[model samples]
Target: MTPDLHWTVTVDPLTLAIGFAHVQVEHTLGHHFSLYLGPSVKCFDGILEGANGPYVGVGVEAGVRGFFWGTAPAGGWVMVRGVLASLSTNVPNTATNLGGYTSALVGFTGIVGPGLVLSGGLGVSYFDYGVLEYGVHGLAPAAHTNVGWAF
Candidate 1:
């Protein structure tokens, strides 16, 4: 077994309207085919105009990543990752509520320079806000890109 560590800074272009970003620490387990876990912080500044705009929120994100091409901790690989998060927000004059989202993605990870890596993927997202009765009714296109430093 080989263990690898990385710090990642992520952005989802599609979520730009809502101002979403993620910061995560990843730990990889196993050798040939790695299984990884990421603990993350998700931050958002607003929502779609129709839903509500200019409200800030923060969430905790958890993710699992599987690399099929080869070992992790080093090298290039093809990966699939699943992410889940829960967030709470308050809008001025509006009710405070909590929401959650999940994503399933297919991507690639490549080592660029010493201790540096880049990863990106396309996926679908499902989001729900129980209190507001508002959500992404079905699967919506999602994309993610991240730059990381591994040690």
Candidate 2:
């Protein structure tokens, strides 16, 4: 077990692999719960390219997590997260895409070594936005994972 950590910041590797930069930061709210905020931005053009131009988006992810037992920063947990975003093209005349994403998941957080942290969860993901018209959104069983250092 690692020492008590008040804040944890994690980056989603899968998102980075696909050109999106995503990160989440969580702070302990006593022994049973914590709150997190994640800001995501599209930094690459290959993923959402349009004939007119490339597309970009800025979004926020926020959620609350419940620790099943024991202290936070480690052990089993449950989370409910919501994401709201707007996507638009570099071209001036295109319409902007907007929508919300929400998920409920169960997962585990562990201190693999010292203050290093690894977390993974499985859940369903939903999205209803103009972006989906471009076939960019998927309604399927999804899983999420992240790696970071806790301090």
Candidate 3:
């Protein structure tokens, strides 16, 4: 079993900035099943204009790892995760009915080393407004790279 901690900063396709701090645990689940779970802090620029707000999120990823059509340090994997985020904004003159959003993410991560990894994926989010006739849809594309030092 290998455990790692990672910090990721993601910019949405519309230039909204988001950041995450996460912990991951990876291990072989028999032959082709691996699992990862972690909690994170999710922040968005559009929600706060430029300041980051805090929201709790969790995710699970499962896929196969190892070289399939290449050599060492190069492999393919697929992952899917869901996040529920909440933020408070001070922006006036707009509809203040929306305060939270739920997002679903699906992406792939490529192995780069025994201690380093790279991943990129896309996700869509929906915001709900109570008693309102309108909502917002958001699209986010993210990339992450992390290096770990085992102890």
Candidate 4:
């Protein structure tokens, strides 16, 4: 059989406008488990409250997927990922500042169709508020619907 190659694109509606995409190559282990890993990229562009200004950044992400549902290509799965990005903001009356955020998220994965995966879960995030000094750290709800294409 040919190797399995799939690409998935995901987005979060709660975080203004944050999205991610990745390409995964699936490797079947025995007859009931599958493992896939790939490089992912995430980006954001929107408004920022306070003196910090607009929020914008590009983060490189690494993700892993594990499927455990017999030989069926569509079923339940899980994912864990980490993201680190270089971020900056343009605050009026202030110099261009630099900051970044690191996040770790885990979610339950489900396949809805021929090539669709729906993942949703909760995660904790740490944000460094650049010049603001005071950062943010808390638990947040995360959800994403990804469409995959296998070939």
Residue ranges of candidate 1 with Cα displaced over 4 Å: 1-18, 32-52, 73-93, 129-137
- TM-score, prediction 2: 0.82
Q: How badly does each model clash, as a count of residue pairs?
A: 0, 0, 0, 0
Clashes of 3: 0
Write one digit per residue (lDDT tens) for candidate 3, span 1-151: 1233232222222322334444444444433334444443333324332224322222322223332322222234444444343333444443333243444444444443444455544455444312132223344343434333211
Candidate that scores best on TM-score: 2
Q: Candidate 2: which pairs clash?
A: none
Model 3: lDDT to the true structure: 0.36
- Candidate 4 segments exceeding 4 Å error: 1-53, 70-73, 92-136
TM per model? 0.66, 0.82, 0.42, 0.51
The deviation in Å at residue 3 for candidate 4 is 8.1
Worst 10 residues of 4 by lDDT: 44-53
- The CA lDDT of each predicted structure is 0.54, 0.73, 0.36, 0.44
Model 1: how far residue 67 lies from native, Å: 0.6
RMSD of 2: 3.3
Residue pairs in clash, model 3: none
User: How well is each residue in 1-151 modelled by candidate 1, as lDDT tens digits?
Assistant: 1244443334444455555555556666655344544443334434654334334445566666666564564444444444444534454455655666677777776665556667777777775533343333356676767666767
